[model samples]
Target: MFVTNVERREERKGPPAGGRALDLLGKMERNEREYDETIAYALALASAWSYADPQALHDVMNSLGFENRCYAVTLSNDAVSARTSASLLQHVDGSAAILCFRGTEPASTGARLADTGVEPARLHAWKAVQGGVHSGREPMARYIACRLKRAMNGQSIVDEKGELVSVDAPACSDATGEPLEHRLKALYITGHGLGGALAALAAAMIFEDKEHEGIRDVVRGVYTYGQPRIGNEIFARRCQDTYGRLLFRHIHANDLVPMFPPPSIGTFEQFGHELRSSAAGWVFSEQPARRADTAPFGSTVDVLAWVKQRLPLVRRLQRPFSSDEHAPHRYVSVSQRSLRLRRSELGLSLGRLRG
Candidate 1:
C-alpha cells in the first residue's frame, strides 16, 4: 500500500501522531512471525520518505525501539552475512562493522544512548575528562544518575510516571565493581555526538588506573563516526602520552555532524599526537544509511580542506605536534573485496545467500 501525501502531512503534526506510527512499526518488526509484514510496512513507510515529516520519522523509530535489529549472520558452513532491518542500511564493513540509522533526530539519538544506560551526565563527565581533567575521584556514577533522571522529565522516551520505557543498561559487574565488557561494548557512546570524546576520556581513565591493568590494552582502538563536536587536545594528548599513539579517527566526507570544529579550548593538535585521519564514502545525503563496500582515502588537499572548513584550529595545532614526528604512513584505500576478505579472516562471512 502506498502512503499518500495526506498521510505524510498527518504524521508531521506532532510527536503523538509520530509516536503512534512508530509504535506500530516497532511492534511489527519485533515479531518474527510478522517479519515479512513488517518489512512490507517499512517499505511503505520508506516510500513516504519523499514527503514524510522528520519528526514523524523519529516517532516511527521510537516505536520500532532498539533490539539488536541488525546482525552479522554466520552461516552453518561458517560464512557470514551482514543483515540489517529495512529501515537502516550498512555504512562501512571492515575490521569493525559501522552502521548508520536513517532519518534520526537528536531526541532519538539521546533515547538510544539512554536506552544503553548511558545518561547525559555521564557523557558530560566523560567529555570533561576527555578534555584532560581527572574524574576518578569525582562522584561520576551518582552525578550521572541524578542528571539523567532530571533530563528524562517531560519526554516521550520516558513514561508518565517518569520511568524510562525504552532504555535499559546492563547491570554493572559485582565481582569487579565495574561495567561488564559486553555492556560497555553495547553502550552506543557515540550516538549523542560527543561519544568520541567521552570514549577517549574513558580510555584515558583506564590507561591511567593501575588497578585496571587487566583491560588496559583492550581500550587501545577508538572508532567514532559522526562525532559532532571535536574532542579536547589535552585529552587526545593524554591518550598519546599514556598509550604512545593517538587513536584512529575515521570520518565520512559528507558527514557534517563530525565536521564541526572543536572549541578553541580543546583543539585537536593540543594533545601532542598525530591523528591518523581516513575518509570513507557515505551513500545518502543524511547520516546512517547504507555505505559502499570500499571507502576512499581523502587526498592530501581534500583532507586539509576538510580540516580547514570543519576544524580550522587543527591546521594551526598540527605544527607543534610534528616535533615528535612518527614515521609517516600512507593512507590505504579500502575496497569492497578487501572488506569481505577482512571479515572472512575474522571468522565471519560478509555475503548473503540467494534464495
Candidate 2:
C-alpha cells in the first residue's frame, strides 16, 4: 500500500500526539520478512575496515565497491591525544563517501579510557573548529575524536595495494574556488565498540549546518554496532532531532559493549533506530514515542520525578560488559537480515540511499 504523506511524516516523527519513550520506532515494515543485501555489503565493509592492517583494510574496501581509500591514524595518548585509527573510502559508484572508525583493539589503552570530554549539544563552530574538537557534546572520548579530526584534516589516501599513501596534496577547491567540506555526495559513518561511540558523535557533527567548508548536505546515515553511549541527554536529543531513524544501533543478543558508561552513571543515552537479533530472527525497535516537552531532561525541575522517569531506561540499556556478542561480523549477520528492502520499496528517496 502507498504510504500517505501524513503517514510518512508520522513515521519519521511521530503521530502528532503524546509519546512515552524517545519516539524511535517510527514507521517500520510490520510484516516485512526480507532484508536488503546491498546495505549488508556496505556494513560488512565497515566491519573489515576496523582492523589496523593497511593491506587488509585496503582489500576490504575494494571488495565493497569503493576506491580512493585513505587511512586515518592518531598518535597522541593524553587527554588531548587521539589513539584510534580510521579510514575514508569513496564508493566505487561515486554515490557516497564513508568514514569508518576501528573499534577497540586488543590491548589498546583507549578501549578502557573512562569517558572524560563533555560539551554543549552542538558541533564545533564552523569558524572555531580548531583543537581537534568535532562536537561540543561531552563524554565524546577526547582521544578518539582528536584522532579522527586529524585524519580528516590530513585527507590522506591509500593506493590499490595499500603501498602509496600521502598527506602532501593540498586541499581541494570547488570550481567556484570555494573550499569543499568533503567531496562525496554524502557521508556515512560507522564503527563498533569505542569506534561505534566515535562514529555516533561524528555522525552528529557531519549533519550540522554551520559555516565555511564543503557542503555535506547528504549525511546518508550513522550505522553502529555494539556502540556505547557517546553524549549527554541534550546531545542525544540533538541527534534524534537531526537524523531521526537514519541513526542505527545494531545489537546482537547479550552484547555488552553497548552498555558502557552506564546511563545511571552519567547523562549518556542512545540516539536513533535500535535493531536487535532474536531467537527467531532480527528485529528493529524504534525508541518509544516521546515529546521534547514531556521527556525528562537534565533541567527538569523535580529531581525525584526525573529519576523516576529515567531509571528504568538506564537499567534496560545496561548489559554485562563481557561477551563475544560484541564482535563486528555478528552485527553484519543480523543487520543484513533486518535491513532488507530496496530503496524504492522502502519509501525512502534514492538520493538518501545511494548518496
Candidate 3:
C-alpha cells in the first residue's frame, strides 16, 4: 500500500557505492549549544519564512535585523497537491543569502477531511531515481531546484502580487545575467518538517549539480528541524560528500517525520550530526537512530501496527506530542518574539505530514 505519494521503491535501487550514511555525521558542523546565536538566528529565519506573506515574513526577519530586500520564492506546482514553500533571500548588507523552506502547515491534520483520496498533506514523495538501493532522487528536492529560480522572477501560480512582496524578484541584470546557481553566495538554507526535508534535498541538489559549481559549494551552511528522510543511503552519502561539515539536521523527541518513510525498504536515510532536542534545548551528536517504520509494508502485521499508531490514544501516550514537536514554534520557543501569530504559532493549532 502507498503510505503517501512517496512510496517504498520495491524495484530500482541506488548503487551501494557510497560509505555509510552515518559516517557523514562525523564530518558535519557542530553546534556547541542549541540556543547559540547561530541556531537562534536560523530558527528565527525559519519561522519567518514559513509564512506565505513576504511583508509579514520580512517583518519577522526585519525585527531580527537581517537585511534581505530581494527574494525569490516558490511553492510546489506539482499535481500531488503538495503545498511547498522555497525562497531565496539576500541579506540587506549582503553578508549571507538565506533560503528558507516552510514545513507542513499546522492546519493539515492527518485525520482532517479531504476530497476523495486527497488528504491534506505537504510533501510529495518521489519514485526511485536512476541509482541503486541507496541512490534515488527526492521528488520535492528536484521540484524546488527547478522552480525556485524562476520563482524568484514571480514565476509561480500563487502569483499573490509578487510586486507586493517586500523582497524583489530575480532580475537578469543582477547576477551579471549569469545562471542563478552561479551567483549564490554565503548561502544558508533552513526548513521545518517537510520543508526541512526539501531544504536538505535542495542543499544536496546544488552540491550535486557541479555544473553550477558556483552554488555547488558556496553555501555558507544548512540547518533543518524535524525534517523527514527524502532519499536513499546513497543520497545521504552524496549529501555528506557534497555539503560535508556544512550540514546540520536537528530533531526533537517524538518528531515522527524525522523517523519516517522507512530506510531499508524506502531506501531513505538521514545524514549529518543528529541534534536531538532536550529539556534544556538541543543536543548534537553523530549517531544513527533506530530504524522507524515510516512506511510499513510487507506483512499484514506491519500494516496493522501502522494503523494502530495513528489512533488518538497512541498519540496521547507519547511525549513532545508529534504535533507540538513538528511545529516551527516549539523549535524556537526560546525566542519569544519569534513565537507569535501564524508565523510562529501555527503548529500549535493542527497539522500533519502524512504517514
Candidate 4:
C-alpha cells in the first residue's frame, strides 16, 4: 500500500537507464573499498539536485534501477513553519538507503526566516537529549525521522477508504513478503543548506528514539553541504560520540550559510569532520574553523568584521557575494569534480600496486 504523505508512482517502469546514479551504484557494487567516498559524493550530488526538482531525482533513481524503490514525502506548510520535503531511495537488495532533504526554497519567506532564526528548541521526541537544537529544524527533523522509521518498520497507513494499507515498497521487503530489517544495513542521510541541517539533526533524532533501536545503527553516515549549525555543544558532542568519522559536513568555497546563527547569539556549534572544498579537491579537517584568524568564520557578522578590519576599501567596493557562495550548483560541480579526481587517484594507486 502507498504511504500516507509519500508519493510512489508505478505507471512507468523500465530497465536501468545507465545514468550517473547507476554508474555510481555500479562502482560501489564492483569495489567495496571505494564505497565510502563514492556514496558520499553521490549523496552530495543528489542533495544539491533535490532543491531544483524532486521529480527529476525520482526519475534519476528510477533510472538507477530503483523503480518502486523511490518515495517522496512532503509535509504541508503551517502558519508557523514552511513546507518540508524529503525523499527516500533504497537499494534493490534492501542493503542500503539514502534519505535526502530538500534545502531552503528561495521563494519561501518562511524558509528564509528559518535560516536566520537563531532560537533554540528542545524536542520531546528527542527524549533526554542533552541540548537544544535550531528551533526551525527540530520539528522537520522529527517528522523525517518518524517517516523513515515507518518505512523501515513496514508500517501501514489508513487510506481514504478507511482500510489499512501497507506502506512498504518492494525495496523494503524480501521475497518472503517480510520486512528486510536484517538485510537493511546502511542508511545515508544528506542535504544542502537548511536541508543539510535537518539531515544532521534527523540522524540524532533517529538515534535518540528507543523505538528505532532496531534501525538506528543502520545510519551509516550523515553528509551535509553548506549547513548551518543545527545544535549546541552538548548536542554536537552526543552526535560526535555516536557517529564519529561517519559524519561529514562539506563546505563549498566561501559558503555563507554554514557560518550562521553565531555562537554569540546561541550555544550552537558544529561537530564532525569538515570537508572544505578547494581547487585541489576537498581538504578534511577535524572540526570547522571558527576563529577570526582562521578561514570560515563562525558567522556572517564575523565575516563582515574580518573584511572591515582587514580591508575596508575592498569590503565597501565589493560586498560579500554570500548567496553565490551558498549556491547549490557550486556544491554539485565541486563534489562531482572531486569524486572524479578521487577515482583517478585510486586507479593510479591500484596500477602501481599491480606493477
Candidate 5:
C-alpha cells in the first residue's frame, strides 16, 4: 500500500500531539539491538549536506542534544573543490565524536563521479588496508583518516589549501586539562547514500591501519543509510570478522541505491547487520535482498531493463523519480516510524510482564 501525504507528514513531525520529541541521545546502549533509535535518527540528519557550511551543520547537530558541542569541522580536498565533503563534530563532554559524510549531490560533478566509480581495486601494500575495495572511496577514506590522525594528535586540521581548520575548541584542553584523545570516549561514523559507502570504507581503514590503532578502541559504531556494496568478498570478510557488530546499515523499503552493483558483479558484497525499515517496524537481517543480474560495466541494455522493471512501482508512489526512495528524507521518515513502533512494542511487553 502506498503511503499518503498525511502519513509522511506525521512521520516527519513525530509524536501525535505532545508526548515528547524523540530523545536524540537518551538511552544510548552500545549493544546493536537496544537503544538504536537515537543513533538512527541522529545519523539520518547528519547525512544531509545542508549548504556544506560548518556553522549550519553545527546548528543542526546542536538541535540534536549535543550541548555546548565544539564547532563542526568541514573537510574537502580544497577550498573550491567538490571532490569530497565531510563534517566532524565533537561532543562538549569529550565523550564522543561524529564524522558525517555528504551524500551525492546532483549539482556536484565530483559526487557523480564517485557514485559511478564502483569498480573494485586491490590495495595490498597499503599501510593497513589489504584487499579489494571501492576505487572511488579509498582515497577519500585515507584522507579522512589522515586528517583525523592529526586532530587526535592535537594538531590544527587544514584543508588541501593549507588553511587552518578547527578540530575542537581553541583551547585544545578539557576542564581537567586532559588532551582531546585522552578525554574522548567514543567515535561514531555516519553518512547517507554515497556518504554511507565512504563511512564504511573509513571504518575499515581505522580497523586495519595501525596508524589509527590509538583511536580504534574508542570507535563506538558506524551507522549508515542507503549505502551500497563497497568491497569484495575478502575485504568484506575481514571487516565483518573485526568490527561487524559495530556496523549498523539501515535500508528503507525499495531504496534502489543499496541494491546497486549487485553481488553478481565482481564478488562485491555487503557485510554487517542490516536493519530494513518498513511499516511494520525494523526488520533485522544478515542477508541482503538479492537483486536481478545487472551486467558488468553499466551495460546499457541490462540497466534499462532493470529501470523498466521498477518503473511501475515507482510511478505508483508518485515519486519524482525512481531514485526518490533513496532520499535522505525517506530514510528519516521510515526510521522515525520504526523507532516509535518499536518503542510502543517494548512498552507493551514491559506492561504485560508487570501485570
Candidate 6:
C-alpha cells in the first residue's frame, strides 16, 4: 500500500496554512523548464546580490518579499560558502556574516579578504575534511561507526582499517585551547546501511523529545543517506502530523545506499511527498560514490577493482535468462488462488503480460 501507484492520496497532506505555497511548489515540479528557470533566477539573484552594495542587496531581498529574519540568516550562510568556493559572495554585505572556513592554513584568501575591508562579523576556521579533529556529528563519522559495529558483529566488511581506522586519534590541541579529543566522538556502529539507520534513530530521539513537551516545529533539518528505517517513518509521520515540516533525506542514485535490493517501503519515497513541496527539495546532485570508487567495504580504490578484490567469488554466480524467457515459468509457479486475489486486489492484468 505504501508503494501504491496512485500519484495522489488523501492521506498525504501539506503544511497547514501553506496551501498556496504547496501549489506553487507542485507546479514547479510538474514543469521541468520552469523549475530550472526558478533555480537560474535564484542563482542570478545570489550573484547580483554578491556584487550589489550592502544596502542595495538588502533592498532587493526585501522587495522580493523575503522578509523573514531566518531567511536572511540562511542566505548569509549560503553566501559564506559561495565566497569560499567561487567568489560568488565576495562583494556581499559582511556586517552580519558569520564565516566558517574549513581548510589547511585557513586559506590566506580569507585573511586577505579581511584586510581588504570585507570584514565578517564572526569567523571560525578549521582544517579540511580528514585533516583536522574528527567530529562524530559528521555523516562520515556515522558511516565509519556503522561499519565498525558491523565488523564487530562478524560481517564480512572490506577496507575496514583503511576507511574507518585510517585517521589517527586526536593527540594535540590547536593554538586555541580546545582539545582535539573534545572535538571528535567515537563511532558506535558500522556500514552505510546501519549508518543510515543510526541517523534515523537520532532524528527519532529528537522527535520524541519534542513530542513529550507537546512542542513541534523545533527541528529545521534532518539529513541522512540511504534508505529509511521503520522508526524513521514513524517519526517522520509524527513530525508531519504535529509540526507539518518534513525531514530531508539525500540519496545519490548510483550509491545503491538509498535503493537496496528488493522492493519495499523506503524513507526516500515516504519523504518524496514533502520534497515535492519543499522550496529546494529532492536535488538530484552528483555524489562521488562510484566516481570516487567507493565500495560497500569502504575502500577508496576503483569500484571494479575493489569489488573484484573483495567479492571475486561472486563473479561465478549463475546468471538468469532474459525476463521474457523466464516469464512463463514464473507465472506457472504462482498459485491460482493467489493470482485471483492479486487481480481482485490490484486490478492487474497478468494476461496482458502473457499476451
Better-scoring candidate (TM-score), 3 or 4:
4
How do all models score by TM-score? 0.32, 0.58, 0.60, 0.71, 0.72, 0.24
Evaluated against the true structure, the overall lDDT of model 1 is 0.28
Write model 2 residue lDDT over 1-355, tens digit each, in one string: 1112322453476322222121111111111212323543355446545564555565545544344445444434465444555665543333355667766662332333233222323344322111122322243334323323333343323322333332222332212222223434555677776666667766665566343133345555677777666655666777788764577677777555555443334555677887777643356766521111211231232333335446875444433223345556666555434434332345467566887
By summed lDDT, the worst window of 10 consecutive residues in model 4 runs over: 1-10
Off by over 4 Å in 5: 1-23, 29-35, 49-52, 68-82, 106-114, 125-182, 262-265, 295-322, 353-355
| Alpha-carbon lDDT of model 2 | 0.47
Cα lDDT, all candidates: 0.28, 0.47, 0.47, 0.58, 0.59, 0.25
Candidate 4: tens digits of C-alpha lDDT, residues 131-240: 22244454455444554554465532111122222222223321233454335556778888777877887777667767667767567678888877776677777877
Candidate 5 collision pairs? none
* Model 4 bad stretches (over 4 Å): 1-23, 26-35, 63-68, 106-113, 124-182, 291-321
> What TM-score number comes out for model 5?
0.72
- List the candidate 2 regions with Cα displacement exceeding 4 Å: 1-37, 78-82, 92-94, 106-183, 212-214, 279-281, 287-321, 336-355
lDDT of 1 by residue, 1-355 (tens): 1234434454475332233333433333233321122222232233233123433433433353322212111111113211111112111110111121121222232322222121112233224332211222132322222222222221111212322222222332212211211211111111113333333444555576555444453332333333333334454455567752433333333333343332322333323122222332112132221221111211232345445546756655442111011100011111112222333444433233321
Write model 5 residue lDDT over 1-355, tens digit each, in one string: 0223533576577643222354443333243333376567666766764324666566666766763233343344444233445666665444556788766763342343335344455645322221222444544555456545545654333332222234422322212223443345557788887778777888887887787788788777898887877776777888898888888898877665676654444666778889887676567876785542442432343334356667775334332123445657677677666666777888899999999
Worst 10 residues of 1 by lDDT: 323-332
Give the per-residue Cα lDDT of candidate 3 at 41: 38
